[model samples]
Target: MKTFLNKVLVAYFAMTAGLILLNEPGYAYLWAGQGGTDVYIVHSGKDKEEKSALKKALGGDFKVKFYNVDLLALADYSGKQKAIIKLEKARIVIFIKDAPHELLEGSTLNTKVIIFNSGKDALKSKVKTFYLVDKTIAPPGGNTVRASSGSELNKAEAIRNADAVVVDGALDIYKAAALVVAALL
Candidate 1:
């Protein structure tokens, strides 16, 4: 019995150590990138196009990272906490469509947050909030600007409340990327 217990303990310790090593921030940095991420994107993992567009739009100027988290997974407290930790580390956090508003719960004041197709329940935070709207949807009753193309987005000033900045859905991904890049600037 003593020998069996010792073997079980050794296996448990090995598993724990492996898990710790896999989750270490240094390990992630080494694999993902060498420096801190400038933009951290959390999305539903359904749209590959959106991810590619954002990356292209950001270009080589910024170090961006993407997290493909399932909305249902975030329902768990531990899962939500882990997502929040990553969110807080970013200079800017962009929540693509279907990403839960709950992930914004614990973000720091310095972090800038942008949400595309944000739901009405989006919690107000100390961090700067920018909401991207689809041109087809009605404006959510605040400062809004109509930007159909990248050039239009570049010309338009920040919406007074930044509550809504409309982007044409009919446009190509590059146009959408331009709008997002404009928001990030």
Candidate 2:
């Protein structure tokens, strides 16, 4: 009985320690790309808690346009393709995962991306909620990005300057830590 109790304590400590490890800078946010460059992926549903949590995850200001993708109602790839194309250009893309992977993967989006999945589609197209960011930031110019349909310009600027962003929920703490590391690198 003592041995079993010891094992339980060790497991509890291990889990607690693991949670603290993943909350670093780049490791915390939604996607794997730079704040201003890559597309942003956040899983905030309407007025969900994750929305505020996602904002908290970013190191700086984070204003983004939110959209809900009714995966159940969505049909066909063309609409998905168009949406993906649209997201790739914006500084951040916050939407549900109703669109097809082919459409998303094929879009000309090297920008930051934020995706929200209902613990579903977590493993897809070799990219899970991890926001498999295989893109890079283009040369930084004083070039002002087209203002996203969010809040004020000043507020948006601050979010753009953010260092890290969170994609998943607190349960995916490990991924968040990884995001911090990736962003700093």
Each prediction's Cα lDDT score? 0.64, 0.40
TM-score of each: 0.63, 0.33
lDDT of 2 by residue, 48-104 (tens): 565455445553444344443443246565765555555555554543333433234
In model 1, which runs have C-alpha deviations exceeding 4 angstroms?
A: 1-34, 71-76, 102-110, 155-161, 169-185
Compute the lDDT for candidate 2. 0.40
The deviation in Å at residue 173 for candidate 2 is 3.0
